[model samples]
Target: MKKLLLATLLLLGIVTTASAQLPKVMLKSIDGKSVSTDTLSNNGKPFIIDFFATWCKPCNRELTAISEVYEEWQEETGVKVIAVSIDQAQNINKVKPLVDNHGWQYEVLLDPNSDFKRALGIQTIPYVIVCDGNGKIVSKHNGYTEGAEEELIEEVRKLVNK
Candidate 1:
């Protein structure tokens, strides 16, 4: 029974590790500066990476809701939010304006080529990935509803306690 339990636990560890891996890919910042997941440092802070497009309404709503409590979230958990725009070349130019207009306090990145999106196997927009201090994604939630930010808060809290 002990050996069986050990094996099951080992398998669960492997599965969790695989699911939390984030690819190291280069992307452009809202200011046109180059940024990469490899260099995404937050002083050992938990953060959320959200993939959205300018035209994605749910994405807009999610950002809006998150923005409402973002400052509080940061103060509580030292968590940060990174908004990655999956806008194609045609709509890429609008990303900065949209971000600025909303005054969202997040590090916005432009994934115009969708390379980051493709690497993650993302099928839709408004995808949220919560990562730990070491950049390991601890939780993933697809789509958004009214209270999705609360769900994200739970994940971020887990990271904080760890």
Candidate 2:
């Protein structure tokens, strides 16, 4: 009986891990448009999905860093970025102002309930996922540092060219 229980638990773990590797689930854009993870993939461009919050300092730092090189990154790799805010209902209103103030050129989406974040197992802000043109999650990074966005840009270029 113990062995059977252990086997069952192992199977469940495997299933959960496999599901996490899948592409982004459906989510609503801040503008109220219905957007799906598949939509970005079908756009035939590599994209970055940044799971963040308005109050997260690291998230803001990552965005600021990315903003510095975003224009050139776009020109070089034709990659688009989508910043997904995981702020709860009360804080949702802050997303636009924050993005605008930072002058971030990336697309923004709302994940108030963190549906996408939970699906991707994102437990912290500044979590980044890179998706290929086919909507597959190619790579993911957690947290951020001074030059992390540059590494992210490099990942975007690599995926876009793949």
Candidate 3:
């Protein structure tokens, strides 16, 4: 019984700490600036890391939905969204134009080689990771629906209200 308890405790610890923070990976922003994934933050406020691709229609929809109400979310909870593009290095040129076309105001980063995405073990586009003020990952969401952006804000609100 004692051995089983110890094993369970060990598994719990690993599971809890495995993804507690962002994994360090070298990526670039759409503006051609090198960014370390570990350093993404929002002045001690909760932030969302959204993984996307220039080719994914659903990803585009999700980001567009968020962009529409992003301002209000910031005013209410001081939350920020960081959009990470998983487009290949050659297609990096496409990201900024898309962002501008959609008038998205989020901080956009490029994960050309997918180092950041692979580090997070993300197998799909439109994955969202929510982190608290301290940079600890608080929640994760996979896939998207028409109204899912609202759910994302509620997650951020929970952190801010804590």
Candidate 4:
């Protein structure tokens, strides 16, 4: 009985953890290019998807943090970061300008309809999702602080090595 109970508990934990992971959803780039989440996975590289908003200060901070280390990350892990703007249609115009002004090199996508966001159950800006080469979501962060991108880089390294 004791062994059975322990096994059941372990199984439950695994199930809950798996369900908490993010799901793949389609997204459109600012240039109107469509990309399925599946394409990002199984592509022989890990991908990072950053959910952001033009007006969110934390989102800007998150981008800035990543930008500082982006080059090194590329050189080391070849990881690709895609920034998805969840700005509403009214504020969507700011997406391009914001990216240009900040000199962010990551692919920028617009989610004006919030399809991807809703699918992922994202409720706030500055959310991040990391996927392995198989396109499976490995980790995610809800917000950022100073040096948060460094932690993200570490996770990318782990995923790449796997």
lDDT over C-alpha atoms for residue 135 of model 2: 59
Per-residue lDDT tens digits of candidate 2, residues 74-145? 888878888999899899889998988988888888888888788777787789887766656767789998
* Per-residue lDDT of candidate 1, residues 59-152 (tens digit): 9999999999999998899999999999998998899889989999899998988999988888998999888888887767799999989999
lDDT per residue for candidate 4 within 1-162, as digits (tens), equals: 999999999998666644454455677788888887546543579889999999999999999888988899898999988898989999988999999999999898888889888887778778998877766676768988888888898998887776
3 versus 4: better TM-score goes to? 3
Question: In model 4, how large is the Cα lDDT of residue 159?
Answer: 77
**Candidate that would win on lDDT:** 3
Error of 4 at 10 (Å): 8.0
Ranking by TM-score: 3, 1, 4, 2
Worst 10 residues of 4 by lDDT: 15-24
Clashing pairs in 3: none
**In model 1, what is the error at residue 58, expressed in angstroms?**
0.2
Alpha-carbon error at 77 in model 3, in Å?
0.5
Candidate 3 lDDT, 23-106, residue by residue in tens: 899887788889888988999999999999989999999999999999999999999999999999798899999999999999
Predicted structure with the largest TM-score when compared to the true one: 3
On the 0 to 100 scale, the lDDT of residue 44 in model 4 is 76
- Evaluate all candidate structures by whole-model CA lDDT and list the values in order: 0.88, 0.80, 0.91, 0.83
- Ten contiguous residues with the weakest lDDT in model 1: 13-22
User: Candidate 4, after superposition: displacement of residue 142 in Å?
Assistant: 0.4
Task: Report the lDDT of model 1 for residue 59.
Answer: 100
TM-score of 4: 0.84
